[model samples]
Target: MSAYEFPALAIQDWLRVFCYDSYCADAMTSGLTNSKDTVLRWQLAVDTLYRLIASDLLHIPTLKADDLSAQKAAALDYIKSLAHHNPFSSDIEETSHWYLWDISATDRCHRLIEAYGIRDIPQGELSQGLVAALHNLFAENRVAWSDQPLIAVSADS
Candidate 1:
């Protein structure tokens, strides 16, 4: 495709396997207007992968390790914050709400790339595929970076 749009075959395959399968199921159940939770879950999976990459990019500590539960919590909180601030957060037709999270995710990836001046981002046959897919979707980094890192305390806590 475009120059920024990397042809990550592994990621494209993973998206078809993990995200779209559930997305299609949810869309069918609600006449193509599935619940926000359905879309949120998909976006969270994408965001979590990007956040993991960001952790590595910034040399941030990773207490969560491979467990992205904390990242999930932060993502939900970030979405909630978006819903509070953005009037179109509820507009699913515009691909707002959960889908709009890509703006933030992409911006994060672009920032990481600029910060490190990395030409080719690393990828694994297994894990990095998902991150690569996210990078593909949000190819253009439009959103501005924030000074404060996104973090949310789980409801369980």
Candidate 2:
């Protein structure tokens, strides 16, 4: 499939299996792929991911050259539009989480357009609960993923 046809978030998640924890920077397992020859393994892992992205074309070597510049441009342009209103920006090549980027964009869009009512239920608690549920979903849906319960304690109460 054309890279453009693929979800940017999926590509990004592959880019960063560790999700931003500095501890996971070099932890490429046996099945994990690494393309870079320089620096630490973690850096290499990140570079490998970036190379998959920002390529003018997906250089499969076996596959015939199909100039996907137009499609790539369109996808990137759309992503840039998402980034336009958020704190994140797309890089030439990113060796990190794309899922977070897209989600951040989506959440930002929701924030911009949606109005919330002040409620008796604490938003913080609700947000945390939703986050935990989403984490469970991710662990279940992903092939080999697991997570611990996230606990948040606040002094305000």
Number of the top lDDT candidate: 1
lDDT of 1 by residue, 31-73 (tens): 1112355433333333333433343321112223355656545
* Candidate 1 backbone collisions, by pair: none
Worst 10 residues of 1 by lDDT: 24-33
lDDT of each: 0.33, 0.28
Top-scoring candidate (TM-score): 1
- Each candidate's root-mean-square deviation in Å? 14.9, 17.6
Model 2: residues with Cα > 4 Å off, grouped in runs:
1-13, 16-52, 56-67, 87-157
lDDT comparing candidate 2 with the true structure: 0.28
Which pairs of residues clash in candidate 2, taking residues 3 or more apart in a chain or in different chains? 12-98, 25-42
Measured with C-alpha atoms, the lDDT of residue 120 in candidate 2 is: 30
Model 1: what TM-score? Answer: 0.21
